[model samples]
Target: MIEIDTKKLVIGMYVARLDRPWLETSFLFQGFRIENNHQIEQLQTFCKTVKIDEEQSSPLVSFEAFKPSTGRLNGTPPPPTAAPQDQKARFYEDMAQAKSVYDNVSGSLNKVLTEFRLNNYIAIPEVKSCVQSVIGNIMHNPNALVLLSNLRSKHQHSAKHSVNTCIYATLFGRYLAFNPEQLATLSTAALLHDVGEIMLPKTIVDKKPDELSAEEIAQSQLHTQYGADMLRKITELPAEVAEVAHSHHERIDGNGYPRGLKETEITLMAKIIGIINEYERLTNNPNPKLQLSSSDALKAIYALRDSCFDAGLVEGLIKCLGIYPIGSVVLLNNGSTGIVIGMRQDNHLLPTVMIIRDPTGELRHPPKAINLDKFRDKEGKPILLISKVLEVNSVDDDLRDYILAELVTKNKPM
Candidate 1:
């Protein structure tokens, strides 16, 4: 740790330790990055010197200078046109509409990927069209698509991981307020980020990703180069597509390959894809022994922050998908197994849950919907709270299956 005056701190540096007791200050996070001048000014107001751990610090980034994903100016995020409650309601209302868009994306993207695997020329426009639909779904109300994606986890198609990565990257891009054109490009890059894996030896390509051993991962690194060269050779695709394919494995701390580019040397888009791609791989493994729940996977990524990924972007990821994101099967204080269908922006702890099992673990038909924030006892105390976030695989099979079936048949988790 090095002591530095507040004046010397830059935008992306993670402040490891403060000069004073954390309780004495109003800062919500004990350790954080100086995202804007206002934060630097706050530090300047609070302390003269602070400790910086260089390993955890990211070099200065000017949002205006380079937008890693959007390929455009990173000005202020556009203001929200609708209130938060309206946005939450939109998720429920758009399920049917979102389903149609999702079906189109999965079906068409699969065909394109199949053609690619067969060494047939795949049309760029078809892939772009799928990404366009994803961008639209994300902009409208991401939760419907979010819930659908969670339910579709059982589909077991080869393209499922890529599709999840595309949807999530688009969600994060929308959260970052990328314009439609920028989002189209970002989503397209995300969808094709792993296209090179199709060219690996069938023995390696055929195995579920989680089953790949350490040496197998090393052998597969060439896929990054292959994917980049393949995408770059396509006349119609944008340069960023190739760039992401080439660099998504590149880490900020310089440990990644095949190029081992570090810090700002990796584009913002590549970092975004890297985070999403890894997150998808971590959470979506079909092997029950290997699968991680959404929250568990985020925690794993959190442990590698600054070393493997950007701290701010990692925080943005957690922010985009709340602590117990929708579809997390959780055990509540009342001893019921509930699925998190909606999150409360006001309080991350208390979400809108669909109780699939009764307190005795009996299946509940048309699982009861309860908004924890509003579900109060007669005396007005919060009656039910999430006790723990359960791993999706750990949940009773009967309960998980019932919820998925009901959501599809009834067209709502509620």
Candidate 2:
């Protein structure tokens, strides 16, 4: 122990307790003048060994008496790595499985609808499993949007609507960053969102996209109520989930059908499905004679973002799908036309595209997927690319064949 110019003394180079407090609680060091009566008594008892002023001593003593417990710190924690390829493969596999389950449920629902059976569709174990699987796929795979874009009309209107709703609902859920559990619930709501349509007339239901009369539209809207009623029959169905399916048709501005709920009254999940449903329907080219490109469909939806769609959700859709989404052909500044392969995370505006043909006025075989990020000129300026929006089938090229070939750019995640 050593005393410095200051009133305090140190027990060791690092560890030091107050001299007075140390005397009362821990008697390890000694030899200091006590100013108070309390200190004098404490210090007297504490002083087993003593040392006065020592010239060679520092203020701190090297008393190695006590040791503190420590924790292990041998290695560092591992960071999460990017797994794009695995994610893409998993997405495809999950989507295929979802399609199978969706088809089965659709078939069963069709039979019920045709027979006019009032039995609860949700009560079926297989139907519930199908809904769960589809929802799970949406929650896990970001790129599953491509697989869910179904336009082919099967015999069952409710089934097709359910699949479409499920896809859009899941996409919207992903856009909102909904957790897996929330996504699954939202997916179930979407898939079964239009089960009530089964009750509608076959003539009105089978009405082509071009020939939808006012009565047909009104009758079609009834599906929302019909679906809700079916869901209500199932005692196990959660009220929140049922609400999503029932209220998906209701609008934010109080202009929607059925109850005509506005704003906060409309459940958030329903609102998401509503926006996505409308967008998908408007954009989908039901007429094989005049099909709209994916880009055109998106643009059409974007045009209605504020008035019809929830502003934030529309923005999220744009962010998720990218500006030039899949299935749209674009003419680059270099005079080459290519179909968009997939969206790039960093640059959503410029997605990875499959260059099918050069400006040489000759069609090329086996289109090549090129990353616009790497297509820069020598001066580091961005090259002229995708100056014009070319609708699918707008050009003379074989759009289907181009879509079938999946040659994506390096480092571009699915």
Candidate 3:
């Protein structure tokens, strides 16, 4: 048994002992693998030290709590996510392709969202094509599309939310090993999930979710039925799309709106989109100023495991997006600032980062890139550990603009 400070424990460590008796803590098992940050938080809250079984499997990485950081950088580089086992193309190459596909799909989303808002109808052919293209992009290289989704927009809440949710759903679906046909249906459901919100009063729809009154909250919940009803009327779209639209709000423990669905009753796609929808919503909330950082949002959703979502699928989101997901701006333990550009499935803590600023708080003309898992000091210890995640809005306008405009054009990390 290896004893370490509670704060030093990373995700993959196996805990065989605790400073305090196990009975004192809420842990259900005598010994257990720390699977997510919630468990880590619990340990930190209750225990001063823990003994980890090094031999038991888990990712060997640790990240500090989320906080804001200052300073901006000028380097423009493409955001790239960690590719699946059979990576088809390099980061730059796939990034360009992903941009083209994303642009086309976003245009379609904006037009359809506008059309639905005006006339309550959208062309099925146009949306189906978008789904196919998005799925193809994900299959080719998952990095590019995800980076595109991370590019925040301050306008057209409905349109941007749909596209962002779609990107998140496809990424989650790919991780779940869904077939292409399954992806198409899942993507379609995701992209059009909120079309029914147009039926809502402009006053209710326009307000930040937290600002809504009790009556407005109840009225807003009707969008699921409104959306499902709209989708069901479209003969060309699959029945599952409507089902997902309606049931995505349903929780696993049967407390959700529209219809309270238990675990087995909800379709897998609805369940998948349900988790992604909440993550996307929190990440891209009605108020950008109130948007939760990626890791912060993950922690919020992770708290709802089993009761609000499937436990395994919740882990899938962490695996797919990582603790500090791609496009996250973070401060390193060494006092450098960087953006997360990639994630390794095995270890959610250790990700590939593009360094934006040096320790002196000066911008790196061309940002340096390194994989935390591979980069080490002279003693072979990892040199850079993420100290804190910077919120998107917390970044100054120039930094936000730099991320939106410059980050897309650069080809490779290093």
Candidate 4:
């Protein structure tokens, strides 16, 4: 089977895979021959691409034959509108609020996980409260919560991963303009996406793939079902939340384990969680060699689009988090180095950065915050452009110390 843009799909072609889950729509079979304009129109509305059985297709059309359309697809719910200008003026305040929210959620998660490890029944209300707090912050400003999530500690991988995934899933949902009710469900599902891992032996979860025996690999993959079962036992939670736990590991191409469920079989919320889960693991893998930088993680996910994830959702993630996401360490064209603190809505590539090192390679005692979108040199030329993204620990100086100090300084009362 070969992948083709949905616009290139024609009557008489056999669809082997859709960009979305098969069960979510009305398609009768997992694979079917497109027989009429109605089928093509439906496919176009829901999918950006589909895998076609080359041997089963009629005459193939050139990609250039089609043009991309803008705006949300027909029959799809509209994304949440952008925050009002008055609300956006409180970005700093929102960010500060997000920090407090992050701390509370983190503490609550730690306590909850401790209980789970002891096989104690979880306090569903407490977990729900934390999820609500995260949702509140995300509703105000998702960027702040997302930045905190990206700066997670490696020591608390499992707990932090859960928190980060929750934040990211909420942010992605917001970007898609999901209603408050939808956002809440998505956040709850993400918070417990990895609960099954608590039942697995640490040695197995953390083992290097090369070192793991066949049986160890199988045992490790059981976390999805384990987590789903645990969530189902919580009678108060939505069934969709439990489905997210079960299907977050599933892929668009039917390669994922536990069930190998493909497009349309997986819920949209699960697909969002799956994308973020893979991204978190890629960036925070225990093995240094396996860990990817934020930019690299995005690239890796993009590379897997259509096969491992839906193409449309992957694009949504990239747009939600700018090209150089918050917390990304980058080198500038003028020889300065900095961590991205804010993204310019009008120009994603030009973010607000805190310059930590000067062109002379000297650490600035008071790091300079420059909004690349508005920055210009004495000659009226742009002063700095991001040359490349750097690894989290590439520099000798401690980034967390500088970042925190900068945030505190910026948020200081006049």
Candidate 5:
């Protein structure tokens, strides 16, 4: 019923969920059950020795392997996919347009970073308003969520961070069926989530991973307090906006920085912000050293459910967002590459995609959307199982041109 992090897992506790890699053919493990202290220790030792990095590792067993055993554990079965709901599932074109808009917005936000800082502790009203507007824009145009995922990058400065969080929070608010007013408010809070980072040293903010000392980590932790204080100075903003700004880093398990507040202590909006914040940070492949493939990122979060996130919320995000969240590059089963655009309520797995490039290095024809759910291969099988999800790209590939070229290639005389 309850999930615990693998690190803190105790023996004799009933297993809430069992995880194995999706790539494996079999899921049988002799010691998967932990009924007593000795069994727990053995499992812990086995996990530590062979577990790999939880954040980047794949489940060692497949869903098929674990399916038969779920009845014994009482864990909920994986829900049916959304793909079959539509009479004709077509998603590719919509996602492309969304991604195009997101790329432009992220470009503009990145341009403003020079005006912001982590140590100044100044809440620029203009910047805050800009962030608010961005959230509002996305809320009015729900399709914008596709672009938000792509906007996450290694640069952790306030401008980009605020926009990314706002997009995420707003999308989540929409999924929760909150009205426009509530969604706007959540977006504003997300936009200003990191306004406090201004007080820290630029050296610390931009520190190389290897260069950070214990003191730097402690100093970095103060940004939450600093951000809350900065937001309080804004007289016109809603009062609760500061909560998202303040608690975006606080975890459900009390393992996060600042106050180390647990689930009940953190606001519901703040909890949403925290989940999306970490998701963006980890999935964005922000640091050169920590880039994760889209598949790997999903796997990491799947393992983290309940322990690091709210189970219902996590499932909601996965359902609303789908396997390949926007901005992720995936290799389709038919030897083509595309970027995810958005989820189809009817079919989450076969989302609308923008075919940016082809295996022959050609762009799509007219850069139209391709609905994989309706796309079948020559063999009459679905031709779009995602092979990999692309995250951080140092160069901007002209996705529009790429998509068009792919179509051109497809129609060329054999």
Candidate 6:
């Protein structure tokens, strides 16, 4: 660490220490990136000099100046080191493992949420264990859990939403190269993001904002505050975790509730959870009118870029999920219908698919899975390209049925 005058502070530097004890200030953490002009000003108010951790500082330009990789909205990033040639085979193998992981996590979350409803207490160790398990699985292979999350049961919306949000947030965090500690905190915060809802009456929580009285709307907004208060009472969690629960609802434009914080006032972890939480809700909202398909949700969030979320983080989210995220059903150039089963790091557009219907629109009794990236015609040209994305219910057969069928075939025989 090197001591530097606060006057010399710039964006991207990591402040390790201040001349004064950190507890005296409002800054949440003892160490943090000087991410904006406002933070520099805040530091100047608190300290004339600080110590910088040169190794931890981001070498990239300031968050405001950084640009998302090109051709993203236009195209996918160049393929990572060529993925395994038999990725489809590996995906199924991973799917079986991921299903087991999902079952475990779902059970744990149900217990936690149930406990919170009965008594306002949470078991910190149980949450930490679940977070570690999820992290290990995602780091092993990201596709399996991602695909399973999309198949969440509608009956268990609240519990499953938290689990899916935790997975998505962890995946996004991993894409950003967050350290283990940061990932743990992010995952834990996501797991409990909506915990405050447990405190509200079922009638109020179940109704949509339009159906609610003004008082009901106000009570609903208190979830953020309730969640933050709950976490603060749990001394085991890091302070930032509580901060995320409090500020995830806060928009960059200062229109958000609980606290109308704007831009820099929101912490980075909160921003990450905010983006993922919205995406999850849009895709899985109980109100069908409010629900959006994965592609459309991405577009909606992209439109809010700087005003509601960090632009670079949104781009990171798009990249992590891909143009046609797993579980999206699409029409193929071959006039067939299929569901995206896996993604290729090299090309997001050409994902692996499980063909459920033939060109004649007839259901294929046993769906056939193929890697679009590797499929070729007799002439050695690509055999199929995505013609259009379809709503999950576009086909006569339920999409969930197809996904469950595939999972059953991949997992141990019943």
Highest-scoring model, lDDT: 6
> Whose TM-score is higher: candidate 2's or candidate 5's?
2
Residue pairs with clashing backbones, model 6: 71-75, 79-346
What is the TM-score of candidate 5?
A: 0.63
Query: Can you give the TM-score per candidate against the true fold?
Result: 0.74, 0.64, 0.73, 0.73, 0.63, 0.75
Best by TM-score: 6
Stretch of 10 with least lDDT, candidate 5:
49-58
The C-alpha local distance difference test score for the whole of candidate 6 amounts to 0.79
Clashing pairs in 4: 20-264, 21-263, 21-264, 22-263, 22-264, 23-264, 79-177, 80-177
Which parts of model 1 are misplaced by more than 4 Å?
A: 1-93, 210-215, 377-381, 396-398, 412-414
Clashing pairs in 1: 68-269
Q: Where does model 4 exceed 4 Å of error?
A: 1-96, 206-211, 377-383, 405-414
The local distance difference test score of model 4 is 0.77
**Model 1, clash count?**
1
Off by over 4 Å in 5: 1-132, 139-141, 148-156, 208-210, 360-368, 376-414
Query: How many clashing pairs in candidate 6?
Result: 2
lDDT of 2 by residue, 45-104 (tens): 554323323212233433233222233356644544335465455334544544554566
For each candidate in the order shown, give its overall lDDT on alpha carbons: 0.77, 0.58, 0.77, 0.77, 0.59, 0.79
Compared with the true structure, model 3 gives a TM-score of 0.73
lDDT digits (tens) for residues 11-97 of candidate 3: 766776789987788864455667778889999998988876543434454322311233335864444433532132345555666
Which residues of candidate 3, in runs, are more than 4 Å off? 1-93, 117-120, 153-156, 377-381, 409-414
